[model samples]
Target: MDEQTITGSTASEIAASVRALHERGALRTGDALPPVRELAAQLGVNRNTAVAAYRLLAQAGVVTARGRAGTVVAGVTAVAQEGYAPDSVLRDIGTGNPDPRRIPDLSGALATAVGRPVLYGEPVIDPALEERALAWVSADLPGRPVRITVTNGAVDAVERLLAQALLRDDAVALEDPCFLASIHTVRLGGYRAVPVPVDAEGMTVDGLRAALESGVRAVICTPRAQNPTGATLSPARAAALRAVLAEHPYVLVIEDDHFSMLSQRPYETLIGPEHRRYALVRSVSKSLGPDMCLAVAATDPETADRLAMRLSPGTTWVSHILQRLVLAQLTDEAVLAEVAAAGRHYAERNAAFAARLTERGLPTQARDGLNLWVRLPVEAKVVADRLMRRGWLARTGDEFVLGERLSPSHHLRLTVHDLEDDDAARLIDDLVDAAR
Candidate 1:
């Protein structure tokens, strides 16, 4: 259909009309749409109305803005995922998963959770879990008021948090080479992602300042054991970041502390006490089994209420049974001790691997979290190819990167905490040869 036939009075109506055309196959992918000014004139609407409609379409992933090239019908963008490659025979080392043996047995916790008959009208959060979770999450934030809300996992909490505070096309500052799920979440939500580079000390101050200057509405940070890079925020750097963030008081800051119980590093936050909007999410998937999908988010009252509204009582509340089960494990001294041991185990194994690599001249460090970020002498793709030939599967750093890189990535993120001594040695030898 031509622009003359594309009719709608409001922005939503216009977006809906475009979607209808896309569904009917009338507007094929790559087809350029009329410019905003042209469309507004033709529809007798304000140019801002047309702009909003285009943004709505872009947010829904139905269309894309190509800068000077103009808006065009866009195809689905493929998102990189974590976990095992299907049916791979090679020794897989890229899966960022915690060791299964370390995950506490859930049989007893499950039994304890079964008797509670949660009803539709009941409070969405388990009272016992809330009290304990608040105490646990509140330890890091001493002066602020914190409210706890449970979700399926950290990813779910992030998605809901963004939804509550942001609209389509809102700019969000994300770490460069971010967590895979965070990258996926931002892309699917149709928000513009401004990458803030992360160094050994965590997110760079200059990078965050630049992002704030760009007018980003939200910022997602990892305070400890950052995914892919294992960069934890240093105390001084954390202070610097908080100073930068203070200028943009209204911008929402979300910190995903996914490795809370498993992290070897101490927590440092970007959200200052007077910050207007913020959320801290901690997940049990790493300490508890991933199957036990549970995360507790501590947010300001407004954010909590917004999140709670989305989580409506009988329909979307996280399973009380799961919450209670997590509570049981968190309170049990034996389980807590086991989790602590698991943290030490991961740190030791990763450290050993780093030592071996460093000795071999690769010069890698054993950072916090479940994986080691190793920089190779050569491009990771080339090394990964060579490693595959010798029977190994490793993830290249490029997969976790946000947007384009100035040069090829020479890094690989390896999950060696679970590797046996012999296997680890073999992989090290293979990697060195592959780099050459």
Candidate 2:
């Protein structure tokens, strides 16, 4: 269809019209969409609205933006995901996972969780879990009243939060070196991702400000132990971000504290006392076990209600059995101590590895979380090839970068905290040699 045939006054309507035309064969693959200004003029709408509409189409994978080449019709391509490659024989150090030996044994907690058979129409969150979780989340948040909601994990909580607050194509502020799951979720949901650069101190203020100015409706932040980089938000940085967000009070802020109890750093939140729309989600996956598959979310009453509607009976409730098990372990002093020690163990292991790299002339520092973000002398891809040849698999930093920000990244994110001393030393030698 030509520009004249493209009709609609609103962003959603315009996107729908374009989709209809494409489905009817009036528009084919590789067809160039009219420029934003031209389409806005034709449709009698604002230029920004047309841009938003185009952005929505792009995020949905219906159209691809080729920079100077302009936007063209293209289908969505498959996205890369995180996890182990079951058949790979190389020593895989790229898998960002908690040390399995440290994950608390759930056998004792499981006995307590299995006693009650939950039926439909019953409460989704276990009362014990709810009480404990509320206290856990509220301790770091503002003193204002907060509501709790249970979800499968941090990713699920984030998905629900964004789904409830934002429409398709709406811009969302995400960290530049963002979590893989966050990147995947936003793209699949058809939401525009505005990258906010992460420095040694979490999300940068200027990057966040630029995103907010671009009319982003949501912001997903990691308060501590951010993935890929392992950068935790410093106290001053948190205050700065909160101030920036204060000016844009209506923007929905979602804080994913995925490395909660296992974090060596303190949690510095972004939610202001008076902010209306926000959520703080802490998952038991990292500290307890990934198999637990449960997270506790604390949010404003209205947001919680909206989330509840989406998680209503018979639809998508987190298992109460899982919730109870988590609560039991959280309350058990011995388990809590063990979890505390595990956190220390991770920190020590990563620090030890970093020291080895530094001593070998490749300066590196262990921040937080289960991995080490190391900068190489040359491109990470080159180093990764060398490592693979040496029988080790590693992830390049470019994998976590958004857009062309870190093209040909000179960094590698290695998960060596779980490795034995000898293996760690061997990998270190290989890594240093690979960089050379």
Candidate 3:
């Protein structure tokens, strides 16, 4: 029998053929494809066409080019979003989840949401929820005629925002040690991620400029309490970033203020008032509870319209009940106080843990957020393994990396807010021993 012909005339066509083969199970994950020259000869196309096809596939997360090891199908898996480690003997401090005890109780708020049943063909956003969400977001947003759209969560809003603005293979500027959800979203959407190095003050201006120069079409930034690193944008840093972004007014800028009311730091924005395309997403997941699954997206009119196309009523609007629940809790004075107290509690606990580690000769900064980003004196994975042997689980910094994996990571992101005082101290001692 004759071998199946890899038929294509252009790069896109060739890439489509490979995708078809993969989907049909003829090409399995980790399987190596034919060399560019050999594939070019087989398909009767130029070698450059084959190269472009491979590059496209790599950008789409369909395959990875391993230099001397050759390109192979990428085994895409759900990134660790932090939850229980089933049947593990260790204490799991790596789960990036807010303590359930701190999450505001919704029982009282749910009772208040009993009203006229929501019907199809109604407005996509709840009227009361929209009013409250706007007031909450407008306090920090630059004065402009911004429109609001409600979504399931911050990640959902971000995904839809990027989908509306960017095309496949379009470059997007993302923080180097980015959020796991953001990384997964960009990769799964077939967009090219341009790494912008972030510091304690948030995304570096030089890095943003470089990414802009590379023709990035969009940028995803976390202005406060950046995940995995706890970096927040300072006023000076925001100004520098805005100055850089001003030149690229049309490029989509998405600011995810996931921590919102729960953040210990002030809200500093990267989107200049005159910027043409921008979205500021504020989610209640952290302050209320992840199960609440509600976020408000304030964006330019055009972007809002585009987003609406995907979230129109009768199609995919956020549940009116969920919206009302979030609004009810947010507006309640007692709930608000509880959320504020929870913020302080997280900050205090993280600071205490960091201080404990510092006294052990392992300096750490617990700046802001539920997790502490600790730098290790040795490789992070080695320390992680050692901690695992001592019945502890920790997340390595490498898992949050975007773009190139050029060097080994020597940092760990630990969620210690849920740990008791004694447990935290024990973990710190074990961490020190492991680091040494």
Candidate 4:
């Protein structure tokens, strides 16, 4: 048997050498590298240097470390489906984006951020933004000594939070019909995703218990306006989940409240007071706009420290200008009114579309969020194809499923909030015809 050797004096050099091997096709997926001590001896470096190199590789998604089995090249991560076709003339209702017209205008807010020139070594999070975010997130959080951090977006926050607490191959509990970005993040990080089936009232208690028993290190949940499914955690459901999580108080629990200000339902949390590791992430993407690219993460002090290590000075801090822009808009009375109206707009539009589908005997319900999760009698892919033929693009539920292969799904997630009444009716009629 031939042995694979990576040579470098330092951690960065060794990581770069291994990366080169991967890029050159010398190291394929699942191919194990030399043991840490052996690699250190072979490279003439200390053991800690080799370990640091491996850790850097794991964080970069280039390789994964399995406790006893050793580190190996990580698998290719799947990218989330976003945006639309440039050449297609179809009406794109598959894009999970908030209505642009409803997004608060930022021109005035940008002007207010020009008073001071922020330089290096300054605070990572904007002072005003941090104070406002602390108050907003603390109101719903149950724990004490709540610490707040800001990241570029909800996806960035979740990625960093998971990276700080978990190693590659560690099991993470996720909602079955998960968010696409979440699916991509977990897979790309070389982590195992344990599916916790989600129902109309949020994550099933039995599924959660099963996941906990399987020794999952972390659980990622969306408490309200769950993507694709549009399900909010009912009070009873939240309590049941909290009870189950109480048994495993140390498991890292992350709540992504992406629809924070835009959701019609009250915020329900899964973290209990005694739980040790937890983070609640709220982003302004839906309410303010995705382009703003900012989210506030309220977490336990220890978890905050771990996350801060990665977000230190020059590397990955969220821009102060963007943070200030968000704060300026958040404090404005007129902007608050617009955001409230936008929330109502999404709920009303989704509800109206669901009602239209129900009237046509399709029996669809848009519980919350910007999209409607419609069940079709046929497979979602087949229905999606038919809809495409009729000049419409809809996203199939299979795209959101996690695991080896996609399970049979007869659902289509359609973003119809921006559609006009006449257009929506036409799409509904077309959908009915296509499904039949």
Candidate 5:
């Protein structure tokens, strides 16, 4: 082929040529594929088209680059995934805040989810999910100017939102000792974090004011069931925070209500319209089934549009099958009743556990949501370690700390009601010993 002739061909033609070369044993295993720029020059294709072709090959695991060795056929195989199981119970306590009652048997839906072969470029997400998600997210923010999008999970939504709103070295105000996932996401994105203090009623208004005054461009506040603490945003505090936020209307405000419908308390939206750039992320993992892995993020249209641009149905969209399954369960009156029942069941059980602990002289109190944030007389780590030695695993407050000073609260964060009766008894006994 003439050098001039080859350099002007389309990306598809170059790809075909590469495929033919590969099949003929001319390009064998461990052999370097042509450089993207060189291949584009030789095939007369645009550099971006060649890059795309290379990316497609990489995504298929057909080729991976080694430094200076060029892109070569990948020798390693991908690991197979084990089927998803509820993680709250392996020993059955102190993990996820899952309500066993919220999961409806989806035998029929599974058959439907499995019926068809999924084709490339076929919509990975169902249209019905978007429709129902619209109603679900906006239900609490009714008459407000916000748009909704369905993400694979709340973590995915949070990561993508942070990616779009903030860049490397940019600072965002986060709740100190924030949700573990939030801490991971911000640091992974290379953003500088400014931790604002939070208390029994959620993010402290004074701390937020100071952070804003320091010129943070983004703010992530959890309105209810603050992770690891279970604090909420009271109306008065929310109003006061809103007053402070009004001065910074242009800043992106993110309200992560991960424990939305499962909350024993009512939902109060702090991002009520008039704020220009705000997003509310609610996930079904805590309220319903964790394996469902779906979150609805409501935002001003501008942010939603940018997020939509970044998330492809193939790359990160929630499966249509899962979305349909969730909506079907959520819309069913019987299912809603069960979910409500689950909420009450969890609350009552957690209250009983708290009361029992109190009676045992450990002095723990139960609040809203699927977990209890317990106050301990001794260091939480010491208590948890003692419990582990007696055959229990639990999460300590230090795991949730986003602060630099290691302000370790003498507290243990535990999920309620996943324990067997004997296990619970043993736990209480060990806890009493640990406290004493």
Candidate 6:
């Protein structure tokens, strides 16, 4: 072979070719590639050469290795390349998602949001949405000063807040067994996550006091309807938490009120008036629809402006259309009524299942959320396996753990909705047997 042909045979050459394809939009992330053996044979190259190229690409974060599923491209905007393909066979039990049947339609409201698209560098946020959101926040936190800015979602809000307030390696207090996204967001953003213990009352005041003592700059909490465990912060617990936080006014508090519209529980914000700095991220995903991808970030004006600076012509802005649509849904009396009804329905159904477990001597506790946290007599992992064998899927407690090496409480986080009597009876029977 000549010099040009010899170069093509090198692994770096293959990698460079792949990189060029990606740059030209031919090789995109999330796209599946042929198996190494097959690809090598197709390219008339040695198997080792192809393996080395794939390895190099993976090291560069250009591709991902899906065990038993083969290699796939890993880059930005790879809708065509990766994931449990739009039509994959695996049953997804790991995704902690809501039932779409519950999310109300907003076709009519969306029609109002789509006006003439603004020109380049034009403000992406809707003025009408800002006005309505201001009114909404005023109702929630009367007499307390605040500012509102719309974001793509709760994750976006958290990311922006951390970006503005923290530098790499900064410590932030997060609930132990925290929402996976919250933990991941902090860790990925180069901030350290300090575990704050959680109990039935929600995050313990002791935990907050300790985290502050350790010099955490920020704290992220789910004031009500905590994820995974789904526990609401009791008013007494909130007061205690505020008492501890008041001592450290400089530590920014971020309360994610994710279940506001979907929970029948009373509203009690933990950020006391005296605690000068904090932000509240409220999203409609759980209450409305996941596709909405909209959240309202209410914070002090300085923090608001920092967030706005990130949103201004210098950075990406949330869609005015989505904001307007959310505003329309919020202002509509009928939609509000429907959402309230959905909230009650979720609560009632979930509570009913918990009651059934309680009646069976399992003694499940009733909390305010779309899911229930049930404590089994044995280890949760074993119980989850048994449930899976019986054609039911449930989340184990160990998955939500943080820094501390505490034994799991034999607890199962269950989502109860649209239950069939036979399946429900079978699951309860299996759980009873599993517990024994």
| lDDT comparing candidate 2 with the true structure | 0.89
| Residue 28 displacement in candidate 4 (angstroms) | 9.6
User: Which ranges in model 5 have alpha carbons more than 4 Å from their true place?
Assistant: 1-92, 97-102, 111-125
Among the numbered candidates, top TM-score falls to 3
Off by over 4 Å in 4: 1-78, 85-87, 404-407
Which sections of candidate 3 miss by over 4 Å?
23-26, 59-61, 75-78
User: Compared with the true structure, what per-residue lDDT tens digits does model 5 show for residues 1-436?
Assistant: 6322223265555556555666665666677777888887766778899876766555445567675778886655533111222443334346655756556666645654554555557655466666777777777776767777788788888888988887666788999767777876776676768999888888998999999999898998888888767788888888888888989888999889887777887766567457889898988887567778888898889998898787675666667667777877777787677777777877887888889999988777776777788888878888887776766667777767776654556878787566666767777787789866
Instruction: List clash counts for every candidate, in order.
Output: 0, 0, 0, 0, 7, 3
lDDT of 6 at 320: 72
Q: lDDT: which candidate is best?
A: 1
Instruction: Please list the Cα RMSD from the true structure of every candidate, rounded to 1 decimal place.
Output: 2.6, 3.2, 1.7, 5.8, 10.4, 9.2
Report, for every candidate in turn, its global Cα lDDT versus the true structure.
Answer: 0.91, 0.89, 0.90, 0.89, 0.75, 0.78
> If scored against the real structure, what TM-score would every candidate get?
0.92, 0.89, 0.96, 0.84, 0.75, 0.78
Worst 10 residues of 4 by lDDT: 77-86
Residue range 160-206, candidate 4, lDDT tens digits: 99999998879999998999889878977878899999999999999
- lDDT for position 258 in model 2: 91
lDDT of residue 286 for candidate 2: 90
Between candidates 4 and 5, name the one with more favorable lDDT: 4
In terms of TM-score, how similar is model 5 to the real structure? 0.75
Question: For residues 73-191, what per-residue lDDT tens digits would candidate 3 score against the true structure?
Answer: 88967666656677888888888899999998788988987778878888989888888878887877758778999999999999999999888889999998999999889988888
| Candidate 1 lDDT by residue in tens digits, 35-99 | 99999998899999999999889878889898889999999666667888879998889999889
